[model samples]
Target: MDITRRRLLVLLPAAAVAWEFVRAGTPESAPNYKTSEHWWGMLIDITECIGCGSCVRACAQENDVPDGYYRTWIERYHVTDYAIERPQVESPNGGKEGFPMNEDSSGKNFFVPKLCNHCADSPCTQVCPVGATFVSPDGVVLVDKNYCLGCRYCVQACPYGCRFINPKTNTADKCSLCYHRITKGLTTACAEVCPTGARQLADLKNPKDPIHEYLRTHSVQILKPHMATGAKVFYNGMDGSVR
Candidate 1:
């Protein structure tokens, strides 16, 4: 059967150790979603991004994302002679950048970081019949590989088309925002690798965090605003017409 590839292609390793733990444990012990206090999110500053694709490389290295698949990617929108026609966008190195700069022509380029929106009312979790995917108490949406039946309903329902079934494990996967790394008192690999400070990881509960400050200062919008999934990912300076 020809499979519809709906997600980025990166060659990250399977979560062999983590999956073992998940399968061995009972689901009742899965952390309650309401009691957690912090909500993790990222603020993407389009103005600051240089289309360098450093974040993409960092995420792949840190998470072992598969060669063709990406946990995060950069979108470089290039406008050309065609006005009504859409801009050309490419994901070089799974969107880590390093493309030779094309001469400035009729095309104008802008860089936008892309990732799973991690919606509060995510359509992915809604389609999971076995309760494999769930929203964490801290508001980080994640998938329980143990409970996942390799059903691709979440992949089909996601508007951003960010979810993919792992080739090694045959389960749906996407950016967890480095949930394992974050819970261990470390920043996400992408955020850590961002050279221009374009990506900012913040605790939504922190009144003093810069994410709130950025939102207060900049014009921000989430991807597919009309979807109404209450997506947590926020993009500043995103062009409405561009995805």
Candidate 2:
């Protein structure tokens, strides 16, 4: 293992948090938390989203994302009923400032909030020459900025256009589903701050997680299913016109 990575491994088990004691059914003598027990993902409900930009704002605040770039963003789409024309999409300043009203009123409109799909067979991880980008045991794709070469291969490889060069750190950057918080047994900042509950953090491996019930009842779809990346962020009530 890389020496810097070894240091991170050592820190995770030693660092203490108050929430560690809050877990029920965990005896005082229980073993350390295992990453394999939890596989992280997200759920986005297109119908429930109001384009309020709360998730985008919360993500930026929690992650310290720089201006003119977004870790998560809302896109407004105006689509026609017929397959006659291309849909109009707008994401002003990555929708952090909310949106202007639609004047055309010719077709249905919806808000689509997008982030790193955290694909199981992630292209970003495959193209990283220095082993900086990788999928964790818990299924969250992460970037070890210390190991990144700023080569931008992963940036181009990501089909979702989620990856970007963090000018401040000079490394590839995208959402980790708030890995720092989720590993600590808390929900993601975006999911927690969403006023309408449009976005949700999902633990696919947990039998008790509500995501299992939701998935069973809803006709969920992953973005770009043909790419076959095993994209985990499932969308409910997604329209066919959405790209």
Candidate 3:
């Protein structure tokens, strides 16, 4: 081989390009992934929650959520006797720093973690004028930031108060059930970080999923059944006072 200066220059650039591609890694591909084969949901055991706020912290860190905004959050409910219908709720700093000791002797207090319900008939998706927010075939709702108009319509349409405008993108954002991770066969950050195993990722289409057994054995309910949003998030041991 005759090594020349001109040949070295061309080889060096080609090698650099090849190295960059190698360093970037191959994009994950799932040839067998069938969206119809999956129906995503979440199971939350209210009784198992310790109000520790680990899930909230993990969600923020994983998603790069802006300060003063939350893709997921925890609410501390104080339901006093005889006033169960009007429970006082507080989520100071989205309960990321944990909650104060319950001082109210007359009421029962508990923590409830909140995120997108990923409803089958989500009002958020219904109100998107640009169709930027949509439910995936796998049942996870996602937002296409590039197509979003940032009109806040989805935010107003969501009954669960999940959607928020991202200051950096100027688009509506909410929990996607960690679609990026789920597609790669990983659980959501919140579920992964829950100390008490209170949060669980469920796949309705998977017959072997534990959610089926949990539903059979536990009395679970979705928030606001009256709306009939077809919400998939199931909560066990939820207090009647929780709104």
lDDT of 3 by residue, 1-243 (tens): 997999999999999999987775655743345688999999999989998999988998898999899988999998988888899999999999999887785778888988899999998899888889999999998999999999999999999999999999999999989887887778999999998999999999999999999999999999998999999999999999877
lDDT score for residue 216 of model 1: 83
- What is candidate 2's lDDT per residue for 1-243, written digit by digit as tens? 565988988777765443556554364344355798999999999999999999889999999999988999999999977752588889999999899889888778899999999999998999999899999999999999999999999999999999999999999999989998887778999999999999999999999999999999999999999999999999999988788
Candidate numbers, best lDDT first, in rank order: 2, 3, 1
Q: Residue 100 lDDT in model 3?
A: 86
What is the C-alpha lDDT profile of model 1 across 44-146, one tens digit per residue? 8888888777888888877777778877888777876565357777767756655667666465677778998888889988889899998888878898887
Of 1 and 2, the candidate ranking higher by lDDT: 2
Cα error, candidate 3, residue 239 (Å) = 0.9
> Model 2, stretches more than 4 Å misplaced?
1-32, 83-85
Show where candidate 3 strays beyond 4 Å.
Answer: 1-31
TM-score of each: 0.80, 0.87, 0.87
- lDDT against the true structure, each candidate: 0.78, 0.91, 0.91
